[model samples]
Target: MADSSCGPRPLPPDDLALLSGLQPHDVRKVAESKIQAYRAMIEDINGYIIQLSTIQNTTVPLHASLPPEILMHVFRHILPTGPSDLRLTHVCKLWRDLIFRTPEFWVDMLAISAVTAHLDHNTDSPLSFPSFVVRSSPLPFELDLHRGALDFLRTIPSHVSRIHSLSLHLPLGSDYAAYLTALFNLDMPLLETMRCSTYATAWPIGLTDSTTHRVPDGQKFPRLRKLAFCGPGLPTRAFAFPSLRELKFDDGMFSEPLGPLMDFLESCAQLEVLEMNIQSPARQFRTERDAVSLPHLKIFSLLLDAPEGLWAYDFLEQVIVPATAQMNITWLAGSDHPLRYLIPTSPLSLSVEAIQVIHTLTIRFNYDRTVRDDSKWILSVNGFVPSHSQPYLKLTIHCPCWTLEEDVRPSDALSDLSGLFTCAPSLQKVKLRLDHGITVTPDHWFVILNSFPSLSSLTVRIGSCRSLLTVLRRNPTRWPALRRLSISCRNGSGVHECLLSAIERRAREGSRLEYIAFSGSPRRRLSEHRMRRLEGLVDEVTTVNEVEFCGMH
Candidate 1:
């Protein structure tokens, strides 16, 4: 037979002679091996057909056939990050074309990285950081970079007017005060928000000093609404922005007179929010009868360092914050002035003492996260004064948190807080945190509960229900008004027994609780029999497998 008889190239004549000499079984084996190889080739060809069919069958993976307009829109949503975003340009020639065509993507390059090893880095090149920004000219964009990267700004001075939001951070431990000083000399008509923070290493000896000569009215950023200039040794110039609405100055600014600081603030008439970390003035603040009054200001946060209470009070007296404004002032740690006396008496008549009643009084004792000391505790007495006439006052006294007695909670911390509860004599609801090391014993709990005589509802997480059981077994513990109880049922079945015994004792005293709620202990949620037993003791009983309660308020 010919070599092509089987529709495959026949073996060579020498190979054919060898195969003819082989046994019939050997020939069958060779044919079977060729058949298997042909089958694998057929399967591979079918796989391509199936994938092609799937591509024709599905409408998903929209990018596979995306229109140019839709692709552009998709590219527009990607925030311009550094190297990570630049890597996307190399995916294909189409992406590179899109990235260059949409110049907006390159507008927000923060090129002032301290560690980026762009040894080829410079603003002078055509495809460098400066070029990317230049491509976005005539369009409003954001500029956020370290002060060292001001060359990027110099490279695109023509596009400076189009910048909308500019944030310049001073390089760490570096002096670029001269660059920051010259920045104010430019015109930015479209700028809305400017955040400039740096430690000014040296003061500028300019043609006109800030202390003596104010920046001429409307000199820069005519449309600016927000300005935050922070850190010590800041520029001594007064900024005059007609449209300024928000201003924040941190306390690092030093050796400047209060008059200059106030003078700078007086220039902005439309400010609605002012946050300042009050520092000791260079000179004493002379009482001025004609102080600036912020009529539209809504929020004033003052952070005062030590030995600044007198300054704080003087500042409060000088400025007239409107009745509607909210004030938060953190003074020296050991401030002797009470919170009630510290707040300026306002036309709104909103005072700490006005909190007559609270819906929930939550007292939690936990490790203070803010303080580094592990031995100390943070006791938060949280409550919200329920009202709608104006902003409701939230009264929270961090008592045991401030006490120096680290090992044991000070008795005075809780006892002294009688004044707080007394202020809200009609307080009805209460939640007590007792999971941590609560120094208050069963008798101590009674005094605290008795303090809030009108408390009709109570939720407690105790070391064990044992202390609470002790309280309920007694005469005074039979709270005449405490109708609802929420207890954390942890520890063991002894907790349930403690609860049942307390309920039975209360019932015997003819002062049974109207409702009882149990929470925590997932697997051991009360069985139906136990719940029914509890139902007989109280008007109603409810159990939850797992429960979590938030802060006191």
Candidate 2:
């Protein structure tokens, strides 16, 4: 291609070739001189063109032309992880100046990429995390401190008033007990969300729920909303979290009674989301305590290392939650009895005693941002209310990436679940996952879908698109109430085109698939051309990733 930016071609001033043709020697010599002059001019033009190109290449846009605040907002989105924000300064001197001058960016948030940089043994020229904290002066702080970053303990006394969100990872052998004792003593008026994890070999990892480790008596966390205590520590008592909305206690073995746990729950009046993974001793929360009612609780999930579901039943029975609230209970693989119980007919119609027995098993699917997260799940509905609502009674089994042992099938246990369908007359909306390595076949899924006459919606995960399409094609009366057909597939599997043809054929036959949602890995999703064609075939077609959230958080 021609360089359009280059100036127009330079021309010789005189036509010396014609004079050379008329007079042989003298005119030819004069033509040669004219050619030499033209060559020199051409060289100059080439050099000038190179100079122009250099100028164009050197010109840079630091996004300074756009509003700085808007650009900063974009940068924040680029790396929500926060500490990675400092990398922006290395882009250019302008960006460096802008980032350094922006106190808001530095003040409330500081992420030192490596914690041990300041240690004498780690580096001679240490990268000071405190320097960033200092620059972020007069602004509320959000810190991400990892293991070996205990130097942050030194800065906390001075900046205690400014700390807003703090995530600390205390090393196992270190004296974190004292460090935390000093930490909770400080006045943190602006602190809201705090997560503390430690490797110490104590009953509680970092700060226990005990008042001994809590902030000074007068200092309370009025604005504190979220607390994720993710180590061995269990909050002993209510530590005054007035505004606590979400509390996550993950991976801990509490060696205390249920009284303090109940008290902590009672303290958070505004608590909406609670996730805990604590292992109860053999005794469990069976101390004959009074029921604690949670009015505002929307999502309650428990990940336990307990032996049986009865432990959960005992605890959940005491804590009264709304009927609509979603509860997810997961425990260490012990007895499969809880997940395998057979409800007589309608769970809603069952006696209270029978319901208590059923409650031993977990209830409700874990509501995730996206279904693509790679968590192994065994979903079963105990029974259903006879409401016209879509989600009533139908068992939802999401086995995205099931664990296999010694060449064992993904879920032989689920195969035995075919008996449960005999009791599900009101069941509707069956969504099943199948992909790269699952043992469940399309034929098995087809049989299940065919069994339910009341099945209104059908969703299938297609690792190999042809098999499921073949299944749908084989059964003419697959689902009478089937209005929605959702396909979860890997992108480049050529599934979209096959899906369009199959669903279109179904539409022609009268069971018009009202909605078709196609979801898969982003890289393998259908190209725009295929997506447009698929859209035309169905009334509504949605493209999505299969294990969406399973990948991100």
Candidate 3:
């Protein structure tokens, strides 16, 4: 009755009875499974925590370790004047603050704008003006200002006091007078170095008169050490630099007397190095009436125009040699005269030790189209015997000219070289500049190489690839002690192939070839496979030392 009273209710199984049937050991096993699962999960989480802890302890604290001073120094080294450099400061507030605070960093300035439009429009007038002025403050150091930015230059005088070094590239047709006036007004007391390059064609009318005004006595750069000037129509007005040690002038268009030039140099009695390139064709420079003395003149270079009949022998014998007895003269004879004219016929009578003391002698033959015959001039320095008592003479010749058809044979030039080697037993190195179209035969090079057993280096310049390969294939044995052998030819016409072949031959012969340089048209490209093959045969291949293509043709 109870069961049927409510509509057939289902009966619940007795849970206590079911529990009683389970063994205690089985219950423990079920509990142990649950515990193991919990432990595994806890271990997994702990492992993750340990790994994070290790990373936190070992990782670098970059921001904390970097000092502000180090960052500032790095920024100073990298931040120079330019659109790119200026933008770096805007990357962060720290950079902007650091850059703006350091005034010394902005002192050394470079004004390289060639057009007034960009500088006048983009530059901050007050900031740019003060930055340049600060460099010339306290004491001037160095300032390099490009031409065409005349608008900006007007501000230079305001900051001229801090300038110690000044390099100006004045444009043609600019207001040079105004620029000079501003420059002369500066009180550059500590100025040491000055270089000026003027475009003669650009000067406005009456610019020379304004530029020639005497640099005021009080404003003179008494501490100046080096000075260089280049332009046409330089003033003959004399100036002085008592502390000057070096002076260079590239006045290729000077038609005035050497008096003013010499007078300026004479004021710098302590000058140790002097380089003058007066392009006047007249060799009528009158020697100093008084006893000329440049006791400290250790280095001297002259680029003077040689008179038609007058060789440099008289100048060297009477003036240069005696004045520069202790000097190491590097004469760049850029004239059409023969090399023999420069040397004294009395070298035999001169002391060998005195001649051997010559540290460097460079003879750059003139390549003017006006002079028709441009062959290899024979230079004989005979009489100095190569013995244990005397070492070989060191001579370097630079000939940048095409070989005339008559001077095509290397033997003809080699004969003169042989004679030169015979005369100067101390001839250690011979640098020949051959015509690009002319080929130097190996047989001819052999004769010259045979003459100098003591020759340590040989630099043969071939104008054509065919000729260089011809020489290398023929005379591999002539350069026995040749530590350096350089072959430079026109880049086109398979010249690199010739070089590789020569390198391979040298490798087979167990010869040591140190350096190989190539010069030619830019259109020529040496294949990578060919270069790798060449590298296997030699130590190095350098394409950077390019031969200059210079000719009227």
Candidate 4:
């Protein structure tokens, strides 16, 4: 009989006959198997739901808390370009509204061909800049307009009037008169600096006419301090600026006579610094013995490519003696030969005290060919060295040569150097360069180094390392006061190690060696371990607490 406590009894397919045929164990096994399969199916469904919920939590967008105004300021500092920066406005309504209204972001404009290539090809007017620049902030600003944008700038009266610093580079043969006329008329009362480089064909002839209308009389740039003109065929007529302190004329083709240029300088009485490089081969200047002097001129640099035999020194002497007697003068002449003869020796004696007052003197002797031995040349240089009455002198000598064969070795050329050192007993620092392929014997090196007893720092550049080490071993005492030593040679690996060992040996014996630099070409495929070992020995020296090993090609 079936148990009634089991709730309800199952119906048999063939009633009692089928039930009698089946065993109780088989029925129990089938029922248990079915239960296990349904349990596993439910677990899989639950796991899938959990995975979907986790993905939703991680992939959702999060809103930023920064204010729109601060974000716009950040954007203003970046040069405007790139899809990422442009699409930033589309991220939200707040960003779009803030960026569109901030005109300060557009005040300082720079339009270049590389950046505006797409705009240049699509429009009839390549320079139709986005209107934001035309209606920007009220603050004085800078405008850098390059390539073919000068024509577009002429139409923007508002932009021109507010520019405090303007840089324009226009093509050759463009009508720059309209642009200049606009600049001359613009009421940029606060404009302080202007740099313009224009290349134009047909030469701006109208700009050269001295009789053309001038900058309004009595109008002065009270705050303007600097002006630079880098253009071809610039008019030489005088322009007035009473408050200008620095003036630079670079690569300008002079059209008018020197009289007008001199007049322009005289007008700027407050001018302190003047740099002019005249490129016109045909331009000539008439010397005015009674021309106005530059009373306030502190620094003057004139670069000219005149006839070799031209009496440029006469003009320079005239300018120097009266106008700027108290000024520290720096004269650079680009000539085929040395101009040591042209430099007046008589003036040296007259102004020896005044010239000695100059804190720094730089003489750049540019020679195309080998400098032939000139006795007068040596005497001229020696004359400039102040007498012992002046304070100690700091000297720097730089000679970049292709080969040492052309250089006059100190041993062979010690007479001039001896005279120079004797004239100035206060010499403190000396630098000597012997270019590649030039060899100096150990004996000659010793003689040269010993000449400057007061030098605290010495740099010797040689072509061969073996030769340099031989020299150092011979006379280490000559460099007792040297706190810094710099050596450049060809074979550096073994030489560097030897130098380090020698310096250490000296330091252990009580020598002051503070700094050492070994510059040379390294051995092929040297490992870092080897390099470090070489560096460590030099570092261990007493006077040299720090050492540098560089591998230069």
Query: Which candidate comes out best when scored by lDDT?
Result: 1
Q: Which ten residues in a row have the lowest lDDT in candidate 3?
A: 357-366
Candidate 4 residue 498 C-alpha distance from true site, Å = 29
- Model 1 misplacement above 4 A: 1-78, 84-98, 110-124, 148-157, 169-185, 200-222, 233-242, 245-249, 253-361, 368-376, 380-428, 441-456, 464-553
lDDT of 3 by residue, 1-553 (tens): 4667678654335533444556899767765776697699999999988678655533446424666676667765663556455575565555566666555455433332322113332345634544435532443344566654344445555555556677777554444455555555556676778787866543345434423444334345667778787875343333345677887877655444454454455455677877766565463455645534566775565554432213334434433332222322223332243333333334553222334432212222224355455433322221222332221232222231213232333334434435333344445665555543445465555565665565665555556656546565556665666655555555554666776776677667766577555555567766789878866765776553342422200
Q: Which of the two candidates, 1 or 3, achieves a greater lDDT against the reference?
A: 1
What lDDT does model 3 reach?
Answer: 0.50
- Candidate 2 residues lying further than 4 Å off, grouped into runs, are 1-98, 104-109, 112-126, 146-158, 169-182, 202-219, 238-240, 253-259, 279-283, 305-307, 331-379, 382-553
Q: Tell me each candidate's TM-score.
A: 0.56, 0.48, 0.48, 0.49
Model 2: per-residue lDDT, tens digit, 427-501? Answer: 565555443544456665565555456766766554555667766766645575777776665543565566666
| Clashes per candidate, residues 3 or more apart or on different chains | 2, 14, 23, 8
User: In angstroms, how far off is 368's CA in candidate 3?
Assistant: 18
TM-score of 3: 0.48
**Whole-model lDDT values for every prediction:** 0.60, 0.55, 0.50, 0.49
For residues 113-229, could you state the per-residue lDDT of candidate 1 as single tens digits?
A: 421335233646645656666666656877666645566566667888888888777542323335445676678889899887765554344312345545445556788888887
| Model 3 C-alpha RMSD to native | 23.1
Weakest 10 consecutive residues, lDDT, candidate 4?
375-384
